[model samples]
Target chain A: MSNTKLVLVYKGFERFWHWTQAFLIIFLAVTGFEIHSSFSLFGFETAVNLHNKAAWALIILIIFAIFWHITSGEWKQYLPTTKNLKAQIEFYLTGIFRNTPHPTKKTVLSKLNPLQRLVYLGLKILVIPVMVMSGLAYMFYRYPQAGIIKSANMEDLEVIAIIHTFGAFVLVAFVIVHLYLITTGHTITSNLNAMITGWEELEEDENEPSVNDEPVFVTEPKI
Target chain B: MQNFKPILTFLFAVIAPLVIITLALREPETDHELLNQLREKYTHQHKLGIDHSKLAILQQDFTNPHAITAACLSCHTERGQEVLKNAHWNWEREAFIPGRGVTYLGKKNLINNFCTGIASNEGTCNRCHTGYGWQDETFDFTNEYNIDCLICHDNTNTYEKQKGAAGYPVMGADSPDFRNIVGHVGRPGRYNCGYCHFHSAGGNNVKHGDLEMALLTADRTIDVHMGVDGLDMSCVECHPAENHQMLGRYYGVSSSNTQRATCEQCHGSVPHTNSKLNEHVVKVDCRTCHIPTYAKVNPTKTYWDWSTATKRQDGKPYELVDSVGNVSYASIKGNFHWQKMAKPEYYWFNGTADHHLISDKIDLNNLPMKINTMFGDYHDKQSKIVPMKVHRGKQPYDTENLTIIQPKLWDKEANQGALWIDLDWEKALEKGMEYLDMPYSGKHGFIETEMYLPISHMVSTSDQALSCVDCHTRNESRLANLTDFYMPGRDQNSTLDTIGKWLILLSLAGVLLHGIVRVFISRKNKIAETHK
Candidate 1:
């Protein structure tokens, strides 16, 4: 084995945010399914209370994550591009099976490949937003103090519940696919190790452009 | 194939919602023509078979209700005798109430949270009474001609009864001319029955939450049976009278006869087309699904605090109407809380109800005595979940004797110690007890009481029945209080659920393990190739 220099890929706050968000999501999904009467883990009333708390925690985590992404100029990692998209799809479908090289190279600045960008973009912009909005609508459906916005119609609530459930299934599907993809890295444990220690070994040729050499856009303008 | 997959996914995503919306928006096919033909046939069949013009006895100008009844008895000799035997005419019937043994209880003998009792106030209360001149205890119950036939059989809708007149139709100012008012005496319409039933306890739509004045010309949404656009059914359609004995029984009062009007009589035991919903019939009453709410048009009195009855310094009764225009405060009655479009409280009831009879001593320690308690539970075979309007009130009761006191609410004489006349509790209690010959402890205090009134009318359409999720959900279920039997969607098992979750997690781990093994094998092969 050749000597390799360890590099810090994930920032301290980013790791903290990611782990906290993951914990909250897992807690939410567990409590949420219990609230749906899928199981009797925490009893009904306790499940509902825990689910609501987890939901709020997730929302706060998402807010902090959003601020962090914008401030650190890391939001660009989820920008979708058509270039190498077909190749990336082919790599996942057939090339991965044949043990062929990845069509697109991953970098610190452009960590996500084309397909990853699209999927992550959809999650952030579409699925997550839809889940958040619908969840909030369900939570505050009734306003006792407000005379006008007193309660939602029962039929409308049924529709909201359907949409929320649909979003939940989508998220569950994404998580399942994500767990499978983590093993598709250079080595079986490479991706898992990178995420934990925030250091990853890069190919000699792929290491030409340092992460620091990337174009610096002002994340926060001076007042 | 790869390109085709996304295209198919996109197409399916676009078309699925469209198909769902189209199916949702599709109008349900109905045979309006057939419905119209059936309605026509029903209307023809329902036409009054009696021709009053042919009967020369009906053409006579009758001055009083008894005179009219006597004229009618000449042809229908047995009708008066049958009518005289009814509980409505006698105002007393023998019935066994649970907790209280077999006793003579009726509107006359039973004390209600509203109006207290009819013992001393028989003259005023007898306005709704079927027979005439029940002013005192000596009023003959055996008199056949005393029955006011027009109260139940009037078709002209001109029948009117005034308070303090002892069941006589109003004379002079409020009276309709008997000459023009005489018409074909047919089966009672909504107005005929509603005249006394709907307008009970004082004004129209005041007493019963289910029976409202709006039912006279209500739409299909208000009451499925009585609605003008629907069945347009009169009271006697369901409550058919055999020998002047009505088939229906009041909620609080126990019926003497076993014959009572039930939805199953017409709809059968299993009414719903869906077998699953039909299964619920054994446990749930028809009204629980049909009548989602009661008093749709007008509010009904739910809470009455009689302790608030205060008289003015001028010796006149003071009254206060709430913002909703309900009589909140009245010196004669007291503070009342009314509610509109009220959702009924659910209970398990097996036809019979146990009432706290006037003669029975109340357990004062169990404050807020249940004046009438509905009997049943989820486990009982005879019991079905029924909806009811739980009317709450604080009425005067004998503190020492621990019995509800009957106050003389009204009297014709000016200084007869009526509660409404002088607002004196002691004097009214003494007079009221003297009429019943029951001892009152002389010391009276207002005690909270509850009366359960079963809701049977104002049934909405089938589509308006509570949605499945309303009860099958985790929380806020209508049947949340009913926990004797396990409901599938609302309940879960800890052990089974845990095992199921573990199985799913184990399957996922197994898949991950398989993938890791494959990756490991491929890497080992690559390492061997590199060494070669």
Candidate 2:
């Protein structure tokens, strides 16, 4: 226990966003599947209304998160890196089984490992964008009328619907993998506790302080 | 962070419009104040400038229906010519049917599941025809005097055309006084249109399930538009006429989308206060939701098996009435099945239709032939899912010729080979074929057929309209049969669904396996450390 120190790895807004987004994703999945006629829980109409509201909330949160990421210089944390990518993969696949230490060290400056960077980047750039665009398309689909000028009208919803559904599937898969990966932290509940309390128990020797010689462990809350 | 400022701004520039447009373009809640303003501006009831009873020409005692028409032509000279070109008098109108070029299609040549056609049954069927003396092929169509002026125009509602009298007014002691009827001529009422339309195919509530005599005194529940307690609109209100050429054309006869009397004509496209409901207007017709069920009051004919005809009751044609007082079986007609408050079948229709012509060849193996195909699908941009009253029946068809037979149904002469009079299928078929001058095989058999009559009327109030679950449900959706397009809730791609389930399951399994391995390794490491 002396070899490790408690570090404020996740900022306050980061934790807030993480939990809020998690709730939204789960809420969206439940109501979305209901709208897809999976089961009748809240009923079709209520399910639709709730799903639409959750989608809008998620979109607004994403916009705020984007602004936060850029202004706080946190966007660079997700920048793609080939450095130790293969080792990270091997650590998850086999190294974890042998009880070897994690390949990547957790620091306040670099919160995500190389694989996390790629996967999170893919979700932000690809999956979430696709979901949002397709969802918007579904909402603003061109309806036929007499007076209005016809412009780039989407006649059929087949493509948009399929794409949206596929995005939903991908999102669900990501959430499942993400929940499971949380358990692979230093302790079984360490990752979950870190996300909740914005602090993680990190091995002292593994973490290197920033160029400014900032303390490795900080008691003060960030943002 | 400063280096990415422009990129962030650019991203926002792209996203801001999407959000703004979404909020802005939500069809502003149908302006009720504007709608009321427009309704008042457009729907003022028009009154005839001159009272017909005050006219000197109408004061004369009319002898016959033709004589009454002659006197009408004397006053309104060009009115006779206008009536001649009309579909009612002509019995057929030139229409550009898709795949069949410009052809004259109407009740004159249109073949239906019920009563077939009017080719050989001209004498009996012509009672509903707008003109007089269409008893046979020799009857003059050019004679403007033959057009019955009082049937549609008679405000008295006493004008009754006699059965098998070649469209003449009933002449016996029970005859309506034409002199009084001629004096009170006005615009066509619901009763005037209902006289023929409601009672087509030999009885009331037989043809169009949406239309019936109950509409004359309909409350809001029966019909929101025509309900006396509601809008109190007449047939001509929705279906207006210009120079006697009525705007609406029945899809049963007409093919093209032109001349349609749509709710959009008066109500406009976006008629709902809820923008979500309004959004569906593009893909779903107003009638689809408004008309949840048709034939609300009277049980319309749903099934008629002509093969079961010719059955004699005490050697005389007799009707068998069901418990509901509906004629279940008629020796003259066939086994009839009737239903009231019937849920309508839905179809993706773009106003255009393809009718089964009398001359078209039929494939007997492919039974339950569609008599009229409503042409549209999910892909068609103009198409919308419309509610329809699908009348199914088994009618006489030529076994050898593979064509539908127009049976001679009625005649005064017992020897003239009318099926109603003689109860003989062979003679009726032969005479009907002779009348049409079309090739017919002597052999006749019953073939399963269906006629799609779009339910446009009998609109219920918004509260009575179908809820989201009605058509958007996993099981027993009203649009269950229409699988051409994906409707959320109602339709889910089975392949995608299976893949989605597998993806989630596989991810769960992978995580569980990894978790167990990690737990075991941690425990092993703990034991080894303790042993050390």
**TM-score for each candidate, following the candidate numbering:** 0.65, 0.90
Q: What is the C-alpha lDDT profile of model 2 across B1-532, one tens digit per residue?
A: 8546645775576446446755864545555775676557546776888877787877776666677788888889899999889989888878787789998888888898889988988888888989888988888888899898778988888888888887987775667886688777888999999999999887878889988899999898899878888668889988999999888868887788988888998788888878788889978999999999999998899999999898997888899999989999988888999999999999999888888998999977777898998999887878899999888999898898999999898889897899999998899999989989998878889899999899888999878999999999989999999987768888777899899999999999999998888788778989999999
Best by TM-score: 2
Runs in model 1 lying further than 4 Å from the true structure: A1-223, B1-45, B98-101, B172-174, B255-257, B313-315, B491-532
Model 1, C-alpha of B295: deviation from truth (Å) = 0.8
Given the true complex, what DockQ would model 2 score? Answer: 0.47
lDDT of 2: 0.85
Residue-by-residue lDDT tens digits, candidate 1, B1-532:
8546645764465435445654654434543454465457545537766786568777766767678888778888889888877888877677776556777767877778788778889888898888788887888889887788878877788777776888888765567555545566778788888988898777766678889789998898999878898778888888988888888878666643366788877667766655446656756788887888898999999888877775664867888888988888899888888989999888888777766777778887897898877778765556788888888999888888888888887887767989888787789888888788988888888999998888888989878987655666767777787777555346555544555456557647855775776677688889989999
True C-alpha contacts between chains kept, each model in order:
0.07, 0.66
lDDT of 1 by residue, A34-98 (tens): 66666667765566557666676677668768987998999989888999999998887668767
Best by DockQ: 2
Clashes of 2: 0
Model 2 per-residue lDDT at B69 = 81
Tell me the docking grade of candidate 1: incorrect
| Lowest-sum lDDT 10-residue window in model 1 chain A | A214-223
